[model samples]
Target: MTGAMVTGAPETTGYGGTLAAEAARFAALGWMRGTSGNLSVVTGRDPVRLLVTASGLDKGELRPGDMVLVDEEGTAVPGATAAGKPSAEAALHARVVRLTGAGAVVHVHTVASVAMGRRRPGGIAFRDLEMLKGLGRSAHDEEVVLPVIRNSQDMSVLGDRLEAALDPGVPAVVVAGHGLYAWGADLREARRHTEVVEWLLELQLAEERGR
Candidate 1:
């Protein structure tokens, strides 16, 4: 697919196609089953344009037409064929991108992540794990704290709180009772972060259960 144009208006097709591909890959992994996740890619820099998954579509069946183009304020731009309204957490995605200057944001409801978020004290810790290096940590000895924010239906309020709690160096955060939100300079890095975090959560859960 061609790179998205940086025009202030929506490059709906380009962004939508990218989201669809990523969504399908995540869905196949069961990380976003039954419309439980959303993905977005920044299509423009100036004025900040984004293409994100629309609400209520089955993630496993996501199509290029199943996405919507929105401005920085989360409003749907005119003339773009949006599949439906943008995801309820669109504001959260916008906040992350605005704060981190990330190119893409991905959220998923993996079983391991949900369980770990529920049981983790304060936050999940990845220490002495080789996977920690995947997240830009220089060494396995480093302790990386993945911030865990409380979940709420009031996304505006939640988004505000999350933005306040974010640590610029961290690439991902977990929402209590919800799921994981991860981002990176591009989709591959973002997805890799998600995979590493999910794996760490599973390992932590297993260790706790054995105790």
Candidate 2:
């Protein structure tokens, strides 16, 4: 947030190492199996340039150089240094950042998220849970409906639906039949939000099964 938004691609990606580490952690949890998920960090604001994890590489084995610089449209910056291609979902990630001003984004394929996306495609409501505070919501007597948007192969289509379904108060969104996307002021906060939302979704699924 300190430097001005550079109009061109940055020569060095200062966040690659951190993002690689985070991606490995998520991969270890089985939330980012194979190359199924991606992590991104905002490098600029006004123009919204970000460093996103490269596509088709095992998230668990990502190196510091395994990333690509992309613009708001998810197109790789022409002169950006990159070890691989940008993830297919980069556009949606950019959309989230543009809409929310989030500093970082985490996308993962968690079982709980996929299940809830299918079970509650419209949306899933959470209430009266202490964990709600983790998502910046009141702990008690509060209801939060996490948006669930249908998935699409085209990032534009997916981004459109996500824009319509987004809850400004909610930092996370579930892609029905696909996965979860979470964001925050930074990578740490984004990761925390991702974990909290996933946990809440798991609890919701359990409650439904018990009833």
Candidate 3:
């Protein structure tokens, strides 16, 4: 093993392109702006490599090179370059991927999610919503509880609580006073879940305000 150094090979160019596109799209939709959100897509499975947005970079301005490759443990692989350190929520993303075997994770600081999470005394409950089908539920009549956990600066503690609170079948969760975390079998699916959950939360808020 003399003169041998561990290094990470470059991720497929296609993966980087897809990551940048999604980041830009989300940013444009106002789901992730001012570098307030994080997104990741699994690139490889055997070694569990993922292309994730770098911390502190405006999602709207994300370039192909702004994405970094990290392993399942949240360790940055060598040769990957980004504008800043990985998102502080990297650990939480890794936990969700490990638990759900998800291919992608999208986190955002949408106004609806933040407001709903804070106003709801317990957690977010989605029932009889046709949009629920987007989250893999076959019927809209079922109640889907999107667990809302207290936000914390400590990543480890937050990750632990998120893992414990997440229901096996649910595709998303909200962090009280923070934002939402959504995941799916792939990037597109994850993005859809984010949109659906946000819509549900906004509807819930309107209903509450009217009451």
For model 1, residues 5-70, the per-residue Cα lDDT tens digits are 434323334566667888989999989987888988887777787788889989888777787777
After superposing candidate 1, which stretches have Cα over 4 Å from the reference? 1-3, 6-12
CA lDDT, every prediction?
Answer: 0.80, 0.88, 0.80
TM values, all candidates:
0.91, 0.94, 0.90
Candidate 1 backbone clash number: 0
Error of 3 at 73 (Å): 2.3
Number of the candidate with higher TM-score, 2 or 3: 2
Which residue runs of candidate 2 sit more than 4 Å off their true CA positions?
1-13
lDDT of 3 by residue, 32-61 (tens): 867899988877777777778888888888
Which regions of candidate 3 deviate over 4 angstroms? 1-12, 138-140
Top candidate by lDDT: 2
Candidate 1 TM-score, C-alpha based: 0.91
Error of 3 at 180 (Å): 0.5
